[model samples]
Target: MENLPKGSPKLINAWAFYDWANSVYSLVIATAVFPIYYESVTSSNGGMVDFLGITLPNSSLLSYSLSFSFLIVAFLSPILSGIADYSGNKKSFMKFFCYLGSLSVISLFFFRDTNTLWIGILATILASVGFWGSIVFYNSYLPEIAFPEQHDRVSAKGFMFGYTGSVLLLAFNLTMIMKPEWYGIMDETLPARISFLMVGIWWMGFAQYTFHYLPSNVYNRKPRKDFIFKGVKELKEVLIGLKKLTTLKQFLIAFFLYSIGVQTIILLAGIYGKVELGIETSQLIITILLIQIVAIFGAFLFSRISERIGNIKTLKLTIAIWGFICFAAYLLDKDNKYIDIQFYALGGVIGMVLGAIQSLSRSTYSKLLPETEDHTTYFSFFDVTEKIAIVLGTFIFGFVGSITNSMRNSIFILAIFFLLGYIVLSFMKKIEPVK
Candidate 1:
């Protein structure tokens, strides 16, 4: 692979702008608006609802839907990524998923009643696949667009942009939700639905800035007519090469271990607060907004810390902090006199590490990669690990909560995943940063 030029602030900023585009999906659809909306629409009578042929609890239904979506992505991303690398069309693939996800978000407007519950379920699945699928190609751009020394800062900048942009949109949505009458709308559901539409538009519109700057292929490969077969051949080569890339493999193992805890917690926090702790919807939104607001600073702060102490140690610090968060969460209860305060405290801690861990992990993986043209294929493996971890995490969390009828124990159990991540990191052979 040829070494591409880097240090272009304009290109870096343009690439980072995609985060500003897509993050509304994470905040508005996945984390905030959609879950609450789903519960309100599906759990209408406060009883089990019939989904397809099966009757299941509303929370379990959502969890299973998300797990199933991640499973699909995990299976498909590597093959698609291989095609993308061979075809020199990572940007186009990213754009395709962006459109699919955004359009699905807009389709969610019609999911207003129990009869249309399938719309919400199906849209959520498609929207999630769109978002996460786009991410595999997006993350591949890091090594090609920025120098190794700049990876931590650039990755954090992207995340910071995401956190700030999503927080702004989520805050606006919260206002519309909490004070629907202010907008001359009588039905609160109308504003929530409108927020979903806004997310779709916001995602596609800002993404054009990135699409304009990101090249079709940084390596400038000219794939032949047999590119489809070539793509599979390349992926097979990468899989075989993995045996010799011990450092990269070890880091991915550590990453997979921690993501099981981190991603699941992010996905489930709002629901757990609402269902288990009896927190109000408005309060949950406010708390999530707070986490995003703090995460911006956390991303920036931890990037600097990684610069000082090195990426490996910085990631270990985050792993330790996350484990503590799980233990602290286990102690929280609905009946406590200061339950809200404790919940907020947990949110604060989550805010502190959320961006730090994510930013550091991405940059760290980029640092660990060998100089190769198959970046999309390699990053596909990275994304696949996380998606599968999410599947496991959500499945375990939901299965435990269902059987025990308690979210607390489910949350506490996640501490073990973090501990395993920390131990794996401890043993990982540190590769020197790319010069």
Candidate 2:
């Protein structure tokens, strides 16, 4: 592999483009636009509360749904990943899931007013599952394309490009919102739906570059005739791998716990701003824009910091920053005059830490794996833990907010997760990369 040029510009560009492609889902559908639209369409005339089976508000229900969806994915992703690995069809599985997610996101266009709340919710669930399932294979491809030495740089580059792509589309979508009259869209809702469609189109269009440039690894063995049974066998092996994780049990436990907090923060940031702080929808979009813009520079900055302090130390620093951010969020008041300032500060802090935490974690985990043949199985475990974290964090936050009627108070509890993670991370000795 070294005899071949490390990675060509085209290969790198193609790799980064996938990040650009899928980030539309993250920026528009997951974080900024869709949640606001969902709340608006689903809420009562009061414009804040929703009517689920119980009398829960839209914000609370959305949080609960997000958490529930993550829990479902946590149980299922390992099984899917095992199937993909046993079939030697990771790319095929990625493409199938991408289409499923994209189609589900586009289906959001049909959900109008409060009439089809269940339809909207179902679409969201399917899209969320597709988005997450595709990422399992997407992330598994990292080691295949780049050698160990280039992993951090390549991962950093992919994240930076993702932020850039999301920001670009966001800038366009924001313009459409700011000047809806110019686009001849009668209602605000139409344009938002159009924006969702745009994400699907953009994802499908740009993804072709990666599909064309990134060659699949050659497997000399013929696929098993009874692929279903083969998948089952592989899944059994995956369970055995999970059992072996007991050797690094402490680190795994800490990662699982802290990730819940991190996932909650990412999933609920937009809702928290709009619902808790009463920030305008436009302002929420702008705040996300700020995060993406700053995140590009932050990625580079944190990369340098990781070089100096080591990835583990850098991650600990981020955890400390996250704790402070959570405390500050909890302190916000209903008046909301300082809401924008708080969001901007949070965005900046997150931008600085986000890249470091993700890249370092991936690099660190890659070093600790038992073998290359088990990469898909091990990474599937990683994906499951990630979903589990999201499930716990989102569930706890949503459950607490619903019971107490205070999003701010719920946010304060998140600090404990970060603090605990930081403490555990400090005791961990970094593993050397396996040759």
Candidate 3:
């Protein structure tokens, strides 16, 4: 491993390209196709899913499964990231997760019947874990790959690639699934199943470009035979160090608060539209595509804004808008004549802030990390924070929807989380470039 130049465009683009490779899982499996497919399948099968030998509302079951998977990853990331850093094999670890995730996605093609419902839920959980687990190591590379000053723009570039790449694939998938007759396919399920297979191949195939270029071990550390226990020691050291890093600590708190709302919205938005609001499958797909398209501009636009107004201020603005989105969501009702139009309007606002918040959050946290070779350990903490937030958010969203039998109240409840996040951000100091 050599000390690579900080601003090498080739290396940076290689790093960004991984986003292109992996984001199909996000758009297709997590956000767009699978959730809608899951809902449609479950709804047709008596609206009750058999999970762990118990029958439950399909929506609640899916939400709880997601919450459970994220919880497992959040607990494991710190230790696993510690080992990757110690062994100087973060890339290997990342690849392992990618394989796990992509393969799990491909396996979903087998999940077509009510009796196979467990396979869908189990596969979804593993796929999510694989995707998110890789992200911990992937994010750790930011501080090593780019100078702190370049963090915002570089992060935005990665997200922009992600949006564009996922949109391209998703649009193709949409055409095949939504209008099967146009493709001369009488079975709608066949195309959707094929989309799953395509996502796995796309994820693993494009990732080769990233793997070809990214350095295997930039620091080139040689771990001792006791590396496993030493990894735990490294993780403990990072935990102790974080207690004294007041600025980073505060930002993590704020991030956790906002993520509760933001992540829940992303994971559940399609399902919410389909089941609760009675939005057509075609309309939902179009709305998600609109988000991906608009998000490219949003990522670049907010990157510049952050440069001009500062990261903290930029983030504050985004969080406030997220709160407003929640409030607006509360007002949407199926009885309204312009319900579809209102939903699209919500999608527009979601797009405007979605990429901005994600890119900015990653860069801001990267900038805040202390000077150390334990990049993976630090980032694991960041990843864990958001993962736990997702757990809490999904659990509460599902719980509320279950008890009340309405998703609107769950949407309204999420608004307070964004408000709390905004208030916490007010106390965070401006970020200084890491020397």
In candidate 2, the residue pairs with backbone N, CA or C atoms under 3 Å apart (3 or more residues apart, or in different chains) clash, namely none
Per-residue C-alpha lDDT of model 3 across residues 208-276, encoded as one tens digit per residue: 888887788888899999989989988999899989988889999999999999999998888788788
Please, what are the lDDT tens digits per residue for candidate 2 over residues 57-105?
A: 6666666677667777777777777767777777787788788888888
TM-score of each: 0.96, 0.90, 0.95
Candidate 1 at residue 192, lDDT?
Answer: 92
Ranking by lDDT: 3, 1, 2
Listed per candidate, the RMSD to the true structure in angstroms reads 2.3, 3.0, 1.9
Whole-model lDDT for model 3 versus the true structure? 0.90
Please give the distance, in angstroms, between residue 22's alpha carbon in candidate 3 and its true position after superposition. Answer: 0.7
Candidate 3 wrongly placed segments (more than 4 Å):
1-4, 402-405
Sorted by TM-score (best first), the order is 1, 3, 2
Residue 129, model 2, lDDT: 81
Alpha carbon lDDT of each predicted model: 0.88, 0.75, 0.90
